[model samples]
Target chain A: MKSILIAMLVAMTLPFGLATPACAGSGDVVVENAWSRASIGTSRPGAAYMDIRNAGDEDVTLTGLRTDLAGMPEFHLTSTNNQGVSSMSPVGEIAIAPGETVALAPGGMHAMLMQLRRPMEEGGTFPLTLLFSDGGEVTVEVPIRGIAARGPDD
Target chain B: MRRRSVLGYGAAAFGVIGMTLFAGWWRVDGPGAPQAVGARPLPLTEMEFSLTNHEDRTVGPETLIGSPTIAFFGFTYCPDVCPTTLADISDWLDALEGDAEKLNVVFITVDPERDTVEAMAEYVDYFHPAIRGWTGTERQIARAVEGFRATYEKVPTESGGYTMNHTASVFLFDAQGRFVSTIDYHEPREFAVPKIRRAMNDEEAEGA
Candidate 1:
């Protein structure tokens, strides 16, 4: 009876669009609007952007990420200097404060997916896993859009 | 009833917060500080430098000056900015309807070592058929870059590789080959398309 009540409570908090319970059982962090640009060729790397919102009271840190579509999926921060010279560097981890939202977008923060297994086609989807510092993981389905698309809404 | 009210309130809060965050993100990602078109034409009517086009043909200021030119400087290896800019320009030209043919779109390589004439030809074709890709000897490329006041340097990476750090602006020239304006690197179609139209209009008016 206790476990049944707990399960009911868990179901109440799990946000919408989270395809499965296996990916996000914590119900603390909500992922939405996950999308990436369609790849031009298989050799070139692709970028994915999304909004990660923390609904829980405690701070959450995204330590790493994984995806089957690419050989490596790593977090990166692109910095452009005053001279319009742009460079991208690896970022250790991203921390989201309670009730705060972190946006990974083009020309800013992005999840660089390198060595794509195949060309990312428009309207196709892939599975992604967000590993948190606390050992929890949230899986999401990212939709592929056109190269110029700014976000899922676009 | 109480649960519904709480959920509604939470959604409202999210709507307000999400909008604020989106606005902030757009400001940072969009073109930050683009140079506007100057009222007076630059003294150098034509930028002079000997370079080879994708067709292995010699090209200089005289060849590029017959039409209003749209030019950018970058390398083929550039993952984000270069491809994004080229794709944006292609979209802008497509939006121009038939007027796209009236302009000359050029891509000059900052890394001459890797971007050969044949490589340039292949790269520009991925974007548009009319887009011309240019590259030459290091000294020749330096002269062209200097003429435009653009800067490029080689940055060594930890993996025993290197990447070219270059100016990310698109330059516009009049039909007479005089410098007219510059669009910020990676400006969206909504922002860059109108500026291109304005340049074409000026070029037509000058011809009249």
Candidate 2:
């Protein structure tokens, strides 16, 4: 299946501890397993999840996110309080250290795509540009899975 | 002397009534209430809701009288818990196979202002065919929330938009409209499916 291929691709892209660090300050942030769910409608926002691995030797802070799929993309966290009530709120940038992987997965941290340009249909892909504080931008193709999909593997 | 005897009888009568009420509470909302991490007791008494389904049909408490029901409160814009829970519900139904049809799954929207009938139709349709979406006016939604003893509020986000905070547990009811149990958010299928079946197998088994 397509998701399996994506999983394989993510596994292959993982750090193997080979190759020298790039000095030009690009490709330092490797994103893997980037996937999103099919939106209910164009008006309602969609969520994109992925794992960000910092391959560089320096600490990099993810400043912002951008995509044509939505008017604005913000880092949102969905948290459940002790009262069994759930709330989603916007969060700040994420920082990744060298050789560290930060996951923006379901039921936790995610990129909330707001005011979609169009519906994110299943079997589709969108380009998401992750802006880093180091003036580097990494764009990854996010595959669209089913509405109820748990993750890229699912 | 007469006052002392009258007082004794009054205390004994109150004690009997208290035990009766507690026994009823213990039967309905006692055990299952604690199993859920943050669950509130599904109202001690019967709760009801009258709303319009995604199919544009009016569904009320009476309409679900003969079947076991699962009612969940959430919104369409909720990307995390709502979708995750709905997916679990879909999987639970799949696990149930034939028995799934015996259950009535209803997803009621807390944010009716944005969740229109058309919106709910598409939302629930994406999860499962049997899952029904319901939406009503603000007043109607408030009544439903109050009746079910659930809570929800619209919180303003930094983007000048609003998101909803709502009860995340799924409520199960017997065919007689009595509260049976609650399934927490992200509850494993091993536990959730049995709760659904338990509700389904209660008094007046479905498909009779």
Give Cα-based local distance difference scores for all models: 0.77, 0.82
Model 2, position B112: C-alpha lDDT score: 94
Per-residue lDDT for B123-176 in model 2, tens only?
Answer: 888887889999998988888877776789999976788889998888998887
Global Cα lDDT for candidate 2: 0.82
User: Candidate 2 regions off by >4 Å?
Assistant: A1-26, B1-45, B204-208
Error of 1 at B36 (Å): 18
TM-scores for every predicted model: 0.72, 0.79
Model 2 residue A21 distance off true place after TM-score fit, in angstroms: 7.7
Model 1, position B134: C-alpha lDDT score: 92
Each prediction's interface RMSD? Answer: 4.2, 2.2
Q: After superposition, how far is residue A116 of candidate 2 from its true place, in Å?
A: 1.1
DockQ of each: 0.14, 0.45
Candidate 2 falls in which docking quality class?
A: acceptable
**CAPRI tier of model 1:** incorrect
Worst 10 residues of 1 chain B by lDDT: B34-43
User: Cα deviation in Å at residue B41, candidate 2?
Assistant: 4.4
DockQ of 2: 0.45
Worst window of 10 by summed lDDT in candidate 2 chain A? A17-26
